[model samples]
Target: MAAEAKQSSYDGSHVENFEFYLQCSGEHESILHFLMKHLPEEFERIGADKSGLAVLGVGSGGGEVDVQMLSLMQSTLSALPITADIVEGSTELVAKFKGLVTKTDHLQKIPFTWHTMLSEEYMQKTKGRGDVKTFDFIHMIQMLYYVDDLTETIKFYHSLLNKNGRLMIIIESANSGWDTLWRTFSKELCNEILPVYRSSSDVLASLKSLGLKYEEHFIPNTFDITECFDPNSKTGQHLISFMTGRENFYQSFTPRVRADILNVLRSKCSTEKEGKVSFNSEMRCVFVYA
Candidate 1:
């Protein structure tokens, strides 16, 4: 008989950090201002009279952040009556998001579709549809780390939007105190135990060098994850995928050395300085018009 693969090995409880991270990184306003780039005073503009607008959310993982954002966006666009669609790579997440929307009375009124698709596939379809400049607000939140081609990605969003439509790409700033501290605090741990994702700013610069005209914002959000590391939480299971490249990622140390590093890092990370445990993050919000 074939060896059974381990089930329930991945924990994603840290996803709860999405809300806290959004606050620490200041992503809350980025989405709203993203809409305003084209429609001056976007918060005040989304009314019934305006042509129903469409917003596309790319890489809307687990739809947790989207849930928080949607609440804020919903009330903001209560005036525009915009239709929003989310592009997610995970089917389970899509179902979860739909459930969240259905359960929430306020969200039920928002006309939204969840496209269970990857960014590349969605972009291909968007291009094949020949709908150049079709979106009013396109957003890529905390998803750029997976892409190798950031410029092409941004251009694709730009192509899919109408002249006045805007695309918002949110990335964490490498220079923020929160990020700086995390890197410093977790350097030994990260270098040995986890695979690091590329920074979003690198991609932003790549787009700018290509001569793309875009506006940007700095928003901060914080997260408290002491319990996420608890042995009892499913959140720890979420590390399986993130650990895919562990062997190479931990290449800097011997196996035993790496293990030691992980233990130390976890202890330090879980340490609380005061009544609450917290870390800050900076999100860079970029807006480019169609």
Candidate 2:
């Protein structure tokens, strides 16, 4: 029998690897730029008639990006009281987020309710309840790939928005190397139990199918994947594992399988220039309105 393929979530033991991948890929810079350029105007419009703004961060890992977003909202609507609800599944990430909040004085002013649970669980608990909270702004960034049902999850989040509210989602774009990689090796690398092999294209399709109004923006980005080709580099291995959504993938897969993946990555997923490989890490930001 063949070995069972397993998918692992980022936790204390492996979250550092994910962070390293982020640093190498420079995805956060693009995300920050997009939010800075777009979120302030939206915040102004959303808080125009409201005394306060309610925000939700779904799968808000470590809260670094979340804080930046909240700060922008504060600056845009200086007098509007802002409260946030955070839903994250990782306990380690939740602790780190809490610690970050304590260190940042501005974030301290905003009241936050933390739920150390998955977005699905949070949705289940709040959906159909009479007193369920609604939000003026909600963000689900780079976290939809792990959800069980992309369409249903998007629908649930869309339903949580108040009038004129927006749900911002960031994910890998259709033109990204991730789309090529997953299309080529989903059976080997993707999570079979969940809809993990998803990209912004899928999100758009789901939005259109559900007849939801949304605006899409593409952010062009690249990843320095030179380390990924180095067989003996621990960082390289971690990057590969993070990209594939598999823990310790270099050690877990057979040598033949690993070689095939590497070949595909080099030939089909990245471009070579001056002996360095640059993987296309383009991202898309979608704003769904209620």
Candidate 3:
């Protein structure tokens, strides 16, 4: 029922709109709040003393969120030397992130190593190196959707954590608007190049099955997706492609399917009030302790 051999829209062409989508979604603010609230206390409990923190950023896109996270952690652990290992695959994004870091003064306080590879590749590299490093905190923010084996990926990252270290993750909650879009269009529009979409609920179930105890927090988010209703709009088409993980998803769909998808977007996936269409963009943050 799904499309065969379609490339994901997360490439360079779609990155701009995807960043816009993230801007409107308010996911970043929620994540910042979670970090500010939990990290200080968590660091304290983990015995913040002589040795500084070692952090890992998995799927760190454009490094914006990575910078924010490190900034806050720096504030909490004032004058504490920190080492960061950044794992990202996109050359352009990593360049942009590094550029941003160069301009920021506080970010320079935390020295970092850049790994231009996927998380699995980084894991294999580390294995080859023989456990030379252990992370005090590892974050996989809105990135697990790229990995094929979620449970194994989780375990691998968890194994990288030092004792009392934390692995934080963020993902869309099930039955939210994002989930609705994927579930509705998956039969015809699903992209094989992308990993199967898994929501926070699915992740929690997987963790439970593995006998892992974790803390969960819900982040209430919403975005105005009115542009998606107009098939002629470039941003709209880009968003459709992003949601379905297909390139030119609007163009790929039959005229009837396109219309139906729009109708469902307006009626089911979004709420219309004051002539503004807002999508249910709730997300969840899960914390697993080592």
Candidate 4:
């Protein structure tokens, strides 16, 4: 079942896609800024309580960002202890992150409970086993694309938070290149079993429907994907694969569809700024309280 899930899922097994996307995108810098602005307040709250904080990281690929957040918390809170529940669907990713934990001196200090499973699978296991663990902070960083049901998953996680707990989600902003690309692909190819691509607007609407109050911040970014102008370039292909969640979008889609997609990407999805073909993305950060 795990093998089947990985095969059909666009994100769980796309380690290369994730890596390529990370290389091209300045998302980490934006996230770092967001964290620096907000984490101090979170640390103050946790410190005042004087109790160990609990964290849940969904789709925590390679633990790079997770460790960053923890490191920030440590520095800001003066080494307040934390118990983190790390949830990742990809076995390869989980192993890579575990390797980091073993080798990285800083990551060694924070305690972690690893769940090598999808968010949905983890939720099911918890429900079946009657586990009622509540986390003070939870995060799903740029990972909603893989989930089958966005609203339900958000609600479920919200329910698992203790009082004053927070759920932080990062996703592409509406009308951005990433948003345009994913919405088009989803309209063309989404199905009951496959992943559905959605933007931060979709998530915000869901929260609104649930009558939940939330906060949002936009992180502006640009990636120079000029190489993608040449459709045959390796970088172009890699960027397409990462954007479309396909191994080889040109080979997988019909010529007409692929051409249309390329046209959208080269035009509607990008702009020339400072003489460089830049993919403009506004990543939205949503914070929900329980």
Candidate 2 least-lDDT 10 residues:
1-10
Task: Report the lDDT tens digits of candidate 1 across residue range 1-290.
Answer: 00001111112433333433444434455544543443445433333345566778887765665666667766666555667788876665677778887888887777887777777777777777654436666778767655446678877777777656667777766654324433553544343212343444675677777777777776655455443334354443232112222313244446675555345434443345664544344467676655
Query: Which residues of candidate 1, in runs, are more than 4 Å off?
Result: 1-49, 131-133, 176-196, 222-280
Per-residue C-alpha lDDT of model 2 across residues 236-264, encoded as one tens digit per residue: 87788777766687777898888888898
lDDT (CA) per prediction: 0.55, 0.82, 0.76, 0.76
Query: Per-candidate TM vs. native?
Result: 0.64, 0.93, 0.90, 0.89
Can you rank all candidates by lDDT, best first? 2, 4, 3, 1
Better of 2 and 4 by lDDT: 2
Candidate 2, number of clashes: 0
lDDT of 1: 0.55
The list of candidate 2 runs beyond 4 A from truth reads: 1-9, 192-196
Cα lDDT of model 4 by residue, 1-290, tens digit: 00012322434447667776777777787788888888778667645665677889998877778888887877787656878899987777788888988887876878889998888898888888766898888999877766778889999999888777888898888888877766766765554544566788889999998888788988788788777657679988887666665667677789888888777877888887675788867788888978
Which stretches of candidate 4 lie above 4 Å from their native place?
1-13, 189-195
Task: Let me know the TM-score candidate 3 reaches against the reference structure.
Answer: 0.90
Q: Any idea how many clashes model 4 has?
A: 0
